[model samples]
Target: MTVATTDLDRLKSGADQLFSKKKLAGFSIPLVIIAYLVYIFFAFDVPGLYSRADMDNARTLVADSYSYKMHVTRDNRSAEVDISIEGRRNGTYPEDGSPDWVTRGEETVIDLGQGHIATFGPEIVTYTIPGYGTFRAEPGRSGVNATFPDGDLPGWINASKNRVAITTEAGRFTVTRNRTEVFRYFNGWEAFWFTLDSPYYGLSVGEVAGRAVQGEAGDIFTAFWTNSMWRHQDVAWALFETVLMAFLGTFGAGLIALPLAFLAAKNFAPLMAVRFAMRRMFDFLRGVDALIWTIILARAFGPGPLTGALAILVTDTGTFGKIFSEALENVDKAPIEGVQSTGASAIQRYRFGVIPQVVPVLISQLLYFLESNTRSATVIGAITGGGIGLLLTQAIITQQDWEKVTYFIVLIVLMVMAMDWISGILRRRLISGDGTGH
Candidate 1:
């Protein structure tokens, strides 16, 4: 009875210590998390970021992604007015023709719906806003002379000695010493299928289909495929280049890493020195980012898809080597011994025994990386000046081509999705084949 009491007391003491540690851990963990969060909040300067944010520019960028703008511009020096879609020469109206909303004669009158009208005369531009009044600006050698409505100038109108800018819900107007421009926002992609020069430019879908049935299919396809404004052919080729980069990089990495993985695997390489060297090599490869690799390769190979491919290959090789080596270490030895007992050579043993065991893992990792590398290739392409990334960068650099940027982004997303789907299918097939001894 005395011994039992002693044992019970010991158990009670151990339980009390465990509970005390648990309580301490529970309290300490939360305190540490809160402290780190506080440190980050101050370090990142969240308040300063909030202050620097511009909601108006953000709103404009968002709007530009979904919509297009038509420009009605008049050269103040020459008094020549031109109406073009997005101010592109290929999108310019034929023979100085104008949209129905714009009336052209001695003066050009653009009717921006909702009681906003702009008239462009010889050397002067006038904007009439309902509930406000007429605003006029005449550009001369000195500067732009401006006049505003009767009351105080509204916040939407910015007028100065050199330029006058008016922004409203319907459109925007800007007048400078060189040019007077009116921008009208429109919904949908402008001249995406057919440019202003094409005969099918303004045709309805039904009408286009009818014309196609009448043997105009080739012409319509040609017009759309060769659209100068959108450059559909060039975009398609760029997408292909991006895919190629990912393909060459991922498979090339896998091929190069498979053999090197044997050197890195602790079980395979008998020499500790060789194993350590291989591991450090892999560390060097993966430790540096893919972007850095892209820059280095670009310097060596010049700017091209090939440089991007090499970057991906170099970066992925280290990753694959580490993963494959770990897989090799965990492999079952029974099959390898069985093959060796049958008088199999070292190479044959690996092929018949080790490879069969790890093929599923190998294929699975390769496919997953292929899908991920497709995305990486895009950024790499941008750095190397190849693939759709180049086009995306160009569009963004222009600043006014946000719609084109949106289109490129959508295409990139679709490309990645397609790669993911294909990789999934390929992975399934490969795994099933391995299971069936194929």
Candidate 2:
């Protein structure tokens, strides 16, 4: 009875210890998570970030991405009034021509749509907002002489001694010592395909198609492709460079990695030292991120598509070597033995036997990486100043051409999607041995 009671007491003690551990783990995990969250909150300055965040600027940026603005600027010194899309000289209206909403004269009047109207006189600029009274300013050498309605100045109008800016739903108007300008926001990208000089600028799609059928296609296409404002030709060439960079880098890595992989594979490399050295080389290559490699290569090769391609090659060669080596290690030995039984040479054994077993994996990984690298090349191109990414970066830096940024982003997405589809189809066809010899 004493022995049995002692055993029961030990069992109870063991159960109690296990329950205590479980309880400690349950409480400790939540406490650790809470502590980590608290640390991160302070470390990243979450409160300051929230305070600094400007929703108004965010909204304006988002709006600019989808819409365009037309600028009607009057040079106060030159006394010259010019109407242009996004204030670009290439998108400027001819001296004899003006938009229906604008009437240029000694005093230029811009209809900002709705009831809002902006008039730029020789010395004075006036903006009239509906429901609100007219806001007036005279820009001169001294300052912007301004007057508001009887009531206090509204928040929408920003006024100072030297400059006065008015903003409303209809448009924006500003006056300074050097220039008086009005910006009217509009939907859709302006002068995307054809600029103001092109005869097909205002034509409907159906009309353009009709003209294309009527043999004016070449003229229309030339006008669009050579457009100075949008630079469709430049964008097309940049896109081609981006694809070429990715293609050259990915395939180059594959070609180079295939042989190097054998040196890293334990089964193929008889000397352990050779395998270790080759594997370490691969690790060194892939260890540095592609962007870091891009920076290094750009300094050496100068900024170009070739530099971007080389960066991708160096990074991917290492990754492919590691992956290919592992795949080679796991390959079935039956085919290799079968090939050897035929009195095949060593190279022939590898080619006819081992390669066949791992080819599917190699091809699959290559295609997947090809698709992934296409996206990476865009960013790489920006650094190298060679591809569509360069154009995108330029647009973003300008701050005035968010539409162009959107266009580039959309093109990138489409390019990536196309590459993904192509790679998928190839992966299916090659890996499954569909419509191909075993």
Candidate 3:
């Protein structure tokens, strides 16, 4: 080796030493800055959290129940129904089959067999049967048959059109027929639940109930939370939209960032001066927080996934450009020189020698940016008025407690973790270092 030593070897060794020192110096400030930022970000909490009233509000929002009101409408229809009273053991239609009515102690039967809740409106006649304390609302339908003993007929019940009023002895309720209406009892909305849901004003449930079930939406639950409460389908759909926003935002940004990176690379750029300018521009772009970008985009385009995506795209361009250019700069000049000595064109030199060396770095950087962007997307979605974060903000503002707040937080965390794991795997396989991604 002492006999064969050459000038090229010395130049290469000196360049490596210089590179190592410069790299170490460059990383120092970034590492310190990152450490400080992570510390502050983790420890920070909303100022509103300190107030007792705010804490109580948050708790109330999260602790709320789940109930919903559905609007139903129908045209005029009536069918006579039979009312009956019998013990659990055995029963038969009474002999005479007259409209037998009963009181708390009495029993009655009618020609029309037992009816459903549809018949159980306030106008419908009903009275206690001897053994069963449960009130029954039989929808009024004409020409049905059953028999009963005598008492005062209650009134014409029509639960179909009014707020259902049903009373019954819990232990003993069964239908002789597999009547669908009878099954309705099992499916009927609970009275307590009615107070928890949002009901729209134009619907009969709200009109009869006095106040809209939810407010602002002008539905029932708004009033009810004002008074106990609960709330998922619509929420889930909105959440789904938020996830979509993140996906599109990240994907679109990656498309633009990839090419800009090559141009920003000092090894690939047409001129050294141009490369320097582009590198500085990239630094400026990435230095600006994604959230700030989102705000700017939202103002330019209005609230939408486009703003979120543009923010990611704009930010990622800076990030990828820096990474790609660094990778280009660090490339082995020996291979490039070998290609050039062969009289290869500039493009051909890069294609054969430079690209192969940097491909791994490009892939690793791409994966890293994609992973980072997912978390950024969530944050941008929140502040820029798109994605699950928007609704999450509402939940926080409304002071819903642990459950509602936990719901979105859990989703976001899981998504970020999944992204990190995937990126790590890709980076390990593609990048030169023996890092976790492998």
Give the Cα lDDT of each candidate: 0.92, 0.90, 0.53
TM-score of each: 0.90, 0.89, 0.47
Question: What residue pairs are clashing in model 2?
Answer: none
The clash numbers for all candidates, in the given order, read 0, 0, 61
Query: In candidate 2, what are the lDDT values of residues 1-438, reduced to their tens digit?
Result: 999999999999999999999999999999999999999999999989978999887886799888989999988888799999988888999997899999988888899989999898877788888899888887778888888889888898888999888888998898898899999999998888899999999889999999999999999999999999889999999998998889999989999999999999988899999999999999999998898899899999999899999999999999999999999999889888988999999999887888778888889999999899989899898888889999999998887687888899999999999999999999998888732224
Candidate with maximal lDDT: 1
Candidate 3's displacement at residue 278, Å, is 1.2
What root-mean-square deviation over C-alphas does model 3 reach?
A: 18.6
Query: Across residues 89-114, which tens digit of lDDT does each residue of candidate 1 receive?
Result: 88899656888999997888999999
- Sort by lDDT, best first: 1, 2, 3
Q: What is the lDDT, from 0 to 100, of the residue 404 in candidate 3?
A: 52
Give the Å error, residue 124, model 1: 5.1
Please list the residue runs of candidate 2 whose C-alpha ends up more than 4 Å from where it truly belongs after superposition: 1-31, 54-56, 121-125, 135-151, 434-438
Model 3 worst lDDT window (10 residues): 67-76
Estimate the Cα RMSD of every predicted model relative to the unseen true structure: 2.5, 3.0, 18.6
Model 3 over residues 1-438: C-alpha lDDT tens digits?
664577778888999999998999899879999998877766674444466356665433443323211211111133222322111111112333322221111222221225322222322333334433334433334321222234433433223333333334211222211121221111122232333222431246546455433234344444433423223444555555555655565556556655666777766678877777887889898898686787788889998667887888887778767777777778889988998999999898878877788777677666776777777666777787776677678767765333456666877788778878988987776665632221
